[model samples]
Target chain A: MIKNPFLRTFSLGVKSLLLHKLRSGLTTLGMLFGVASVVAMLAIGEGASKEAQDQIKQLGSNNIILRSVKPLEESNSNQSTRVSVYGLTDGDFARIVDTYPWAEDVVPVRILQQEVRFGERSLNPRVLATTAKYQSVTGRPMLEGRFLTESDEETVSNVCVLDYEIARYLFPFRSPINERIKIGADYFLVVGVMLPRVPIGEANQAAPGEEVTGEVILPASTGRKWFGDMQVKIRAGSRDMEQVDLHEIIVGVDSSENVPAAAAAAREMLDRTHRERDYEIVVPLELLLREQATKRIFKIVLASIAGISLLVGGIGIMNVMLATVTERTREIGVRRALGAKKRHIVMQFLVETIVLSVGGGVLGIALGLTIPEVVAAYTDMQPVVTPAAPILAFAISVGTGLLFGMYPAWRAANMDPVEALRHE
Target chain B: MAEEKSKAMNVSLEATAKAAADTRAVAEFRNVSRIYRMGDNEVHALDDVSCRFNAGDYWAIMGSSGSGKSTMLNLLGCIDRPTNGEYYVSGTAVSTLNDDDLSELRGRHIGFIFQSFNLIPQLNVLENILVPRFYLEDPGIGLVERARDIAERVGLGSRTDHRPRELSGGQQQRVAIARALINDPSLLLADEATGNLDTQTTEEILELFDELHSDGMTILLVTHEEEVGKRAEQVMRLKDGAIESVAYNRPTIQR
Candidate 1:
C-alpha cells in the first residue's frame, strides 16, 4: 500500500525484531562471539609473529654465520688421531673481505669452554674471542663499563665482557665490572656487561663439557695467543677419545640485500679452499624468512578456524529466522490480507535478520577490540589488534547474516495466505 | 391503518409486476456454474444458475448447509470465480476480469461481511471498519471521519477504539457491517452476518440491514434461517446448487 517500500519494510522489520526480543538477542550472541573470536585470534597471532620478526630483523638480516662441523670419520678414529682440524681460519675471513665487493664488514669469532676461577668462585663458561667490530656488527649493547676497543685487541689486553646473567651469577654481591676473573690459570679483567638476549634455539642449555652459568667475551688477539686453536675432546669409549681443532665464525654483510650474495660467495670460496668439506654456514636471516612464511600460514589457518564459528553463527541465524517464520505465520497472513505484497513480506524478514546481524557485529567489534588487552592480562600470549581485522570481521558478519537470511525470507514471502491463515 | 395496508399491498404488487421492467442491472448471472474438483471427484457448487438483480434492491439467498448459499455470496463478493459461464457486476463481465481488475472491482463496487465476523484480532473496531478502504484508489471518503460516522450509525461510536476481541459478538458483526459499507459499494454481500450472535444481537443486525436497504443500498444476504430470508424484499432458495424457489415481499410505499 505504501510507495516507499524500503522504509516501510525496514520499519516492519524493526517491529518484528522488537516482538521477539529474547530470540533475537540469543541469535545475535552467536554471531557476536564468532566475529569476536576471529578478530581476537588473528590479532594475537599477528602480535607474536611481529615480535619474533622484529627480534630477527634486529639480529641484522644481513649477517651470515659459519660454524665448523667435524667429520664422522674424525670422531670414530682412535684417541691418538693427531688433533683433527676443520672450519674457517684467518685465511677464509681475509679472502672473503678481499675478494667480495659486497663484503662490507667482517667479524670472526673463536669459542672455547674453559674453567674460570676467582678465589672460591669457580665456574666454566662459553668464552668467545672476537674483534671490537663485533659489537657494531651484531648490534649488541653494553649495560655497564665499556665494550671491547680496537686498542684492547691491538695490545692483546686480557679485557673481557660478561653476559648479564653471567655477571649476576659470578658477582651476586657486587658489580663484576673492573673485577679480575681467571680462565684456566689466566687472569682477565671484566670490562663490561651485555644485556640479556633471547636464546637462539631451545631454552638455554650447554653443549657437552660447556658451562651454563655465564659467558665470557675476550679480544680475538688475546684468545689466539693463549688458547691457540683450542682443542675439543670427544670420548667414544672409556679410554678412546679424540681432540679436534675447529672454529665458529659469524660474518656480517653490508646489508640485507647482499646477504644471499655474501653467503654464496663465502660458500664458493670455502668449497675451493677446503680439500675436505668440514664447515657449515648457518644463515639466521634465511631461518627468519622461513619462520615468517610459516607464521603467515599459521595465521591463515587460525583465521580459517575462527571463520568456521562465523559460519556456525550464520546457520544459527537462519535456524532462528525459520522458527520465527513459523511462529509468525498468522501475522504474515494478516498483513497479506491487509494488502501487503510478496516483496514487502520478503523485505520485512530480510531487514529483521540484518538488524540482528549488524547489532551482533557492532557488539563483536567492541568485544574484539578488548581481546588484545584481555589476552595480555590473563594469558602469556600477546595479542595484536589491527583496524583491518575488526573491520573485516564486521563485514564478514554482516555478509554472513545476509547470505543466511535469504532462504527463510523467501519462504516467508512465498507463504500461501489461505494456508498461513489456517496455520495454528 | 387500512390505507397503509392497501398502500403496502399495492407497492408489493407493483414491485413484483415490474420485475421485468427495463432497468439497468447491478448484478447478473448467465448460465454460471461452479464445479469443485476434489482429487478424482467433481461436485457442482452452483449449476447453470441464471439471475439478475437491479440497483437499489435487497435480496436474500437461503439454503441448507450444503445448499451452495455461501458460494453464491462468495461469487457476489468476487472472492471467487465461477467455474463456467459469465457473471457480471455493475455491467462489467466479472468472469473475464483478471485478478488485479477483479480485486479493484471488489474494492470499488462490492463489500463483504462474513458469518464469523472476520475482523483482524489486533486491529481496533475503527481499523477493522477501514480495512477495505486500504484497497481503494482514492478512498473517496476521509477514512477517520467515515469510520467514526459508520461506527456511530451502527451504535458502536463509544467502542471505536476497542479491539475486536474486546467487543461482543453483535458489536463485532456491526463493525464488520460498518467495514462492508465504508466504501459505499454498489452491492453489499453478507454471509450469515448474525450467525454467531444471540437473538437480540441478530435482531439488531437485521434492523441495521433494514436501515441500510432503506437508505438505497443494494444488499445480498445469505442465510439458512427462514426468518432472516423472509425479512428481505426478495428471497431465493437454493437446494443442491439449483434455485428451488423465489418469493417477493410486501414492500411499503415511501410516503
Candidate 2:
C-alpha cells in the first residue's frame, strides 16, 4: 500500500550500506570470488570436453576401428623367435567386408614404424599402407597434390603421401611434392601431403603409447611389394619380430545406427577365425556418448565445489548481518516506536543483503568471463563460455543472499522495542 | 433532493460527535498495573495506577528512579501493554489490539519524544520527520511538503537535509518533535525529553512545548527536574509505583 515501498526500502538499504564502504566492499568479495570460481571452472571444463568431442567427430561417427593388439603371452615368448605370427590377418578383413551386409566400406592398414630421410634430416614416423578408399573412409583432408588412386595401387607405384607435419619437417627448405624420400634401401616418391591426423594431445587413442605423431601413407599393394609383411625392431640387444598381414581395419557403415551391428558381426567373425584375443574394437559413436555422460558428471562435481564456496560466502553475510542487527538496535527501536511492523524491519535488513549479493554476483560474472579469456591467452586451452554459466551463477548468488539473511532479519524484527531503545 | 438528505445526515453526525466529546478524554488509564517478574520476586512497576489526560492539557509525571515513570509513558504511548486493567488512547482500548494493530494505533494517535531525541542517526532532518509516514499505508500526497512545513515550524527549515549528528542537542530534540507531529498525533508523550540538553537549550525546547500546548496539543512529560515540572499546567508525583500527589499550577478554562 505504501508508495514504492520496495524501491524506498531498497534505496534506504543502499544508503545504510554506503555508510560503511569498506565493510560492504569486503563482504561483497566473498560472493564475488565464489561465483567467479563456479563460472570459470564450468567454462574450462566445457571447453576441454568440446575439444575431445571434436576429435571424436573427426574419426567419423559411423566408422568402427579394429586395431591389432599383440597378446602378452605371444609377445613374451616371441622375443627370441625369428618370427611371430599373431594379430589381424588379411583373411579377417576380407571375411568382415564380404559377410557383413551392413559394412559399407572396409580399408585394411599396415603400420610400419620406420625412419624416413630426405638429405640429412631423419624422423621416425608411422607409415600407413592402405588402399585409395582409406582417404574417403577416414575423412582426412588432402592439403597438396592428389591422394593415392586405384591405378597407383594396381601398378604398385613406389609413392607415398606424407602427413602435413611430416612434410614440413622433411622439406622445410622447399616443396617435397615431387621429392624422393629414403625409407630403407629404396627411395619413394612423395606424391601428396595430408592434414595432420588429430593432434596427439586432443586424440584419445584406445591403447596407451598408440598415439602417432606423423604418418606417411602408401598404397597397400605397393607397400606389400616393397616392405613385405614382417616388421622387426631392435631394442637393446634383442630383436623383436612381428609378422601380420594387416595391422588395422576400419569398417564403415552407412549410418551411425548401423555401426553397432556391423561391429558386433565383425567381432564375432574375428573371434571365430583367430585363436588368440589380439584385436580391440573402437566405436566413435559409443565414445562420444560416453564422453557426454562423463562431461555432465564432471560439471556437477565442479558446481558442487563452487557451491561450497558460496555457502561460506552466505555464512559470511549472515555473520556480518547479525553484527549489524546488534549495532543498529537503537535504530530498530526508533523505527518500532515510529510504528514500523516486524515485517518492515525484516524487509529493510533483507533488502540490504540482497543488494550486497546481487551486486557481487554481477561483478563476479564479469570476472568469471574474463578468467577464461586470460586462460586462453596464456595457454593452448579453448575455454568456451556457454550462455547459461553466468545466468546460473547469478541465480545462485541471489538465492544465497535470501537464504543467509533470514535469521538476522528475523532477530532484528523480534527485538523488544523498549530494551532496544535503551541499548547503547 | 440529494443535497437536502446529505445535510440532514451531517446534522445527526455533529450531534453524535458532540455527545462523544463530552465523555472521552484524550487518553485514560483505568487501574492499570504493570508487573515485572525477576526470579521468585514480583516487581510491581506500576500498581493499580489510574490517570486521565485531557485535550490541550500539559501534565508532568515526576518521580525518582524505579518509580515507573518511564513504564507509565511506554504504556500510554501504546508501546507496552498493562499487566492488568485497561488503557485507552483516542477512546480505543489498547488491551484489545494485536501487535500490528497496536503499532497502527500508536502511529496514528501517539507522538513519542525520548530522552536522547531518538532521531535515526543516518536520516537527515527531513527524513527523520518523514520516518513515521514510511510505515503508513497510502502515506498520501504532499507528504514531503508537510514534513518540510513541520521542519520549518521547528526552526529547521534551512537544515532539513542535515543529519542528526550535525545538529545540536536542542536542534535534535526539535527534529524529534517535528517527527512526532508529522502524523498529526492526538497525544504527545515525552520521557525526559530535555534531560540531555543544557539549561539554555532546555529552555528553548520547553518554550516550543508551551507553544505546542497553546495550540491545543495534549502533552505528558516524565521528568525529575522541578523546573520542567513547574512549566506544566499539572504535576503528578509518583512514590513506589503509585501516585503520591497531583498539583495544579493553573486554573482550567471553562469549555
Candidate 3:
C-alpha cells in the first residue's frame, strides 16, 4: 500500500496489533471482562444499599427504640411452671423522660398477639396498646371517622382503631366504625380506619418504625386494666405464665441531628437502672449511618478487584510488546539509521498498546451496561446502572495501557543501533 | 603513498579548504576511535583513525570481515557514535549534535543503500522511496512526482506497487538506490549495493553509480570486491582496525 510516510508508523502500529490477532484479542478480553465486572458490581451494591437506606428512612431518621427482652434469671422454657416478670417498668419510663429533655413523645407500647372475633369471623392480629399521643406521634393519618381521644385513655374505654387491612377484612361491605368487635370475653368499639402501610418485614424491623401493623390500636391503660400482664396458658398437660410489663418504648428526638446523643443518653440510663442488660437500644439513624459506611468499603473492594484484572491485562500487553521489540530489533535499527528519533519509536509502540486497551474499554462498557439490566431482569436483584461506572472503567483501562506500555517502548527506543542492525 | 598522505595531513585539509572555503569536507574524522566492551575484554573497532571525504568524491572503502570496515560504515552513516574524538559532517561537528539534531542531519544530508535491499517488506516500492523524506513537514507538493521521476530513472517506474519480495534482487537494489537518491543528500553511503545482484545487473548498477558520480554526487561505497573499488575514483583499504592505504584508481583527466 502507498501509505503516507508520516502515517506509515501509525499504520505499522495497527498492522502489528492486527498481525498478532489472537494475543491482542485475549488481552483485550481480559480488560473487557474486568471493566464489565466493575460496573456491574458497583451498580448492584449501590442498588442493594440504596434499597436498605430507603427502608431505614421509612422508620424516620430521628426515631430511637428501646426493646424489652425477657431476663435470663426469670424466664426458662425448660421449667414447666413459673411466673416471669421483665422489661420496661413504670419507674424506668418516668426516669427516661425525666433525663432526656430532647426526647419528644416517648410512647410506651404493649403488643399482644390476640385473636379477635365479630360473630362468626375470627382472625389473629396484633393488639397495639398505646396512649392518645400515639396517633400524632406515629404519624398514621386516619382514613375515616376519628382516632381514640384522651377520653378513651382516662375512662379506660373499650374503644379501638382498626388498621386498613383489618378494617377491610372485618367489614368488607359496610362501614365498620362505631361497630363492636369481640376479643376473648370483651367487646371493643372501632372508632377509626387507618391508611394501609408497607409491611415491616423482620429484617426491616431491625431499624425501628411507627407502632402500626395489621392490628388494633387502643389505650395502653385500658388494655393493661382489662387483660393484665400475667398471660396464663394451658396446653399439653402444662401451664405457662409469661409476663412482659412493657414490650417497647418508641422515643422520638426533637431533631434528627440529636438522635445519636439521645440514643446514648437512653442507653446510659437503661444500663444504670437495669442490671440484667435486658434492654437493647435501636437507633435507626445510627444504624443507617453504619450501613452507609459499610457500603462505601464494599464499593472500594469491588473496584479494587476490577483494577487487578486491568493490571493483568496491562501485563499481557507488556509481555507481547517486549517480544515485539525483540522481533523488530533490525527494523528499529533501520529506522534509526534512516532518521527516526527515539520518540518516534516510543510513539509507535505506545499507539499499539493504546489501540488494544481502548478497543477493550469500549467493548467492556457495552457489556457492563447490558449485564446489569440482564441481571435485574432474570433475578430478584435490581442493579443500579450509574453513569460514572462505565466512564471510570474506561479511564482505568487507558491508564493501565499507558502504565504498562512504558517499559517496552523505552526498551525499543533505547536499543543499540549497531547491534540491532546486526540482529537477524 | 599512505605514509605521504598521513604525514602531510595539511595537504588534504588545504585542498578541501581551497575547494569551497566555507563548506570544506562533506565528512571528516578527527582522531576517532570506537571501542566495544564485552565483559572484561575490549575490542578496538577503529583506533585513533582519521580521514576526510571531500565534496563530490566517490570513495570505495575495501576490507575483509572483522577489519572494522562495518564499524567505520556505521559511524560514517551517523547511526553510531565514536567512543572518542569528534566527527564533522559538512563543517558541523556531529559530536555536538544531540540525538534529535543528528536525526535531522541524517534526514537532510545522508542517504543509505544496503546490499540486502532492506526495503520495509510491508511497504510498496513508492512508499519505501518516500521513507527518507517522511520526517519533513510538507515534503512539498512534488514529492510524489519527484519519487516517480527517481523511480523511472532507476528503471523501477513500473514496479512502484510491488513489495520487496515480489521484485528480483536487481530491481530491489534499484528501489534502494531510488530511496537513497530521493533525499538529494550531500552524501550517499552504500553498503555493498550490488553484492546480491548478478554480474550483468552488477555492471548495470555500477553504470548508474558512474552516472550519479559524474553528476557531482558524493558517494561512500563500503565493499569487499576489488572490481567495485576499481570503478571508484579513490579507494581506502582497511586492515585490522587501521587504514592500510588510500590510493587513486587512475590519473584524473576530467574536471
Candidate 4:
C-alpha cells in the first residue's frame, strides 16, 4: 500500500490498464493521429499565407502603380491604318504631378522588350527606362557601384545598370563595372549592378507574352533619343505599329495613411481627362489587406477539419471506457465493499483516461513537428510550425480525453454495490 | 531469547484475561427490519428482531434459503442499512451516520470473510491482506509489519508474494482470514466461510476459529450446516426473517 492516496490511486489505474496492453494501445492511436493532423495542417496553411504576404510586402505599401493599356476600340480601328495612337502621354504625367497635392514623387517609366548581346551571349530582358528618382520610389538597392545619376540622365549617356541575374549571365568571368553591353544598335557601359528583386505576380503584368527573364535599367532621355516613342512589330503576314510615350507611372504618397486617398484622386483625374479607359491602377495596401483576410478564413477552415478528427478520437475513448466499466463491475463492488467511496471509484477511472490521452498527446506533438521538417526538406513547399500550434494541439487532446471520460466514470460510481457484487 | 518469548506470551495472556472479565456488548440491533421492494411488492427480508453480541463469545446464525440470513449478515457488516429501527457498533448509532461515515466505521471496526475468498486477482497475498487498510489514513511501516505478522499467524508467511490463483482453496481461505484480521477489528463476521473447502480443510479452519475465540475476539458465523454450527458456544435459528429458537451448547462464560 502506498502512503499517498494520489500516488496509490494512480498506480492502481496504471496496473489495470497494463493488464490489457493491446486495447489501451489501440485506443491511444486515435488521439495520436488526431493531434498530429491538426498541427501539420495548421503549419502548412500558415506557411502558404506567409509566402503570399511576404511577396505583397516587397512591393512598397505606400506606392501606387498606374499602367497604360491599349484601348480595344483604338486597336481594332487601327487594323487597316498604318500606325496606332493610344496610352498615357507626357501630358498625363505632368497633370498628376501638378494637380495632386498628395503625390509626393512621380516617376514615369517605359519598358521595351529587347535583347542584350555580349560577345556570343544574347538574352531577351525587359529594358526599363526611368530617371534617378525610380530607386527612391521602389526602394531598390544596388549591389555594386552607384545607381544612374542625374548627370547620366541629363547627358543621355550610353550607360546601364543590370540586375544580378543579367550581370552574371552576360559577364561570367569579369566584373560588370565599365563593361560594355550592346542593346539594339548601341553599346552601353555598365555603371552599377542591382540585387535581384522579387517579381510581381502575373496579375500585375502590363503585357501578356512570355515570362520576363530579367530587367536592365537605363536613363529615360537616352531611350527616347535612341529608340523614339514609336515601336513597329511585323509578324507573319501583318504589320502592327503602336506609338506610346510612357508605359507606366509610379506615384508615391506622403504617408501610408494617405495612399488610398491619393489613389482615388489619381483615378478621378485620369477618368476625367481620358475619353477611353486605357489604364489600370493597383494599390499594394488593398491587396495586402485582402490577402490577410483570406489567410484568416483559411486558418479557421483547417482548424475545423482537424477538430472533427479530435472529436472522433474522443468518442473512441468513451466507447472503450464504457466497456471497461461494465467488464469491471465485480471489481468496483469489491472495492466498495472494502470501504472505497464513490469519489474514489470516479478518480480511479478518470486518472486512467488522462494517462492515456496525455501520453498520446506528447507522442502526437513529436510526430507533428517531424512531418513539417520532412515536408520542407523534400518539396518546394515551406511548412512553418509555430510554437502555439503544438501547445494548442496538446491542450485540445487532453481536453477531449476529460470530456469523453466523464460519463463512463459517473456510471461506474453510481452502480449499486449489491448488484455489482452479484454480477458475473 | 526463550525468556523474552515467554514474557511476551504472558503479557498477551494477561490482556485477554482482562478483556474477558469486562462484559460489554460489542454490537446490538434493536427492532431492525430490512425490506426489499420489487415492482410495488414489498418483501420483508428481516422482520422486527433484536439481538445483542458481547465480547469474547462465539455465535452461529443458522437458516435455510429465504430465511434472511444474507440480509442479516449485510446489516451486521454495516454494508446495508435496515429500513426500520437502529443498530449500534461501539456505542455509535448506525442510523445517524452518512455513507462516508459508515464506510469509515466499517474500515476501522469490522472485518468480513466471504466463502469465495474474495481476493483481488491483480494483487498478491500481502497486497490483498493490506486491502482493508488501503482506505485508512496514515499507513506506515507499522501497518505493513502488522500485516506480515497476521499473515504468519495464518501460516501463509512463505506465500505472501504469491497470487491467490497459485494457492489452494484452503490457502486462499487462510489469506482471507489474514486480511480480515489486519484491521484488528473487535467483531469478525463470516458468511459460509468454509463452504467451499474439503472436510479436512474445513476442520483446520474451524480449529483456527477456535484459537481466535479463545483469544477474546467476538465472532458471528452464518452457516446452514449443523456440524459447523455445533462448534460455536451458542446458536440462533431464523425462520422467515424472525428468530425461531436459541440453543446454548455450553455455559456462557461472560454473558
State which candidate has the highest TM-score: 2
Worst 10 residues of 1 chain B by lDDT: B1-10
State TM-scores per candidate.
0.65, 0.84, 0.77, 0.83
Q: Candidate 1: where is the Cα deviation over 4 Å?
A: A1-58, A73-84, A114-126, A132-136, A139-219, A222-228, A231-248, A251-265, A275-277, A296-304, A355-380, A383-387, B1-255
Write candidate 1's Cα lDDT for B10-127 as tens digits.
3454444345433667888766778888999989999989998877788999989888886777677665677765667876766456555666687677777767777766457876
| DockQ, 0 to 1 scale, candidate 1 | 0.10
C-alpha lDDT (0 to 100) for residue B205 of candidate 4: 93
> Per-residue error at A135 for model 4, in Å?
4.8
Global fold similarity of model 4 (TM-score): 0.83
Q: What is the lDDT of residue A302 in candidate 3?
A: 84
Q: What would the per-residue lDDT of candidate 2 be over residues A1-424, giving only the tens digit for each residue?
A: 1258898898889989998889999899999999999889999999989998888887888899998998765334544546667888888887877787877789999998777899998878888899999888888888898899999999999999998777877887778899999987679999998974554453233243343356899999988888888898787767878898888999888888888888788788878888888888889889999999999999889989998988888898899889999999999988998899889999999999999898888899999999999998888788889999999999998999999999999999999988888899
Worst 10 residues of 2 chain A by lDDT: A202-211
Clash-forming residue pairs, model 3: none
* Model 2 complex DockQ against the native: 0.40
* Chain B TM-score of candidate number 1: 0.87
Cα lDDT tens digits, model 4, B117-177, are: 7887777898899987876654456777888899989888678889889999999999988
Using lDDT as the measure, the top candidate is 2
Cα deviation at B103, candidate 1, in Å, is 10
Instruction: Provide the lDDT at B15 for model 2.
Output: 45
CAPRI rating of model 1 = incorrect
Give the candidates in order of TM-score, highest first: 2, 4, 3, 1
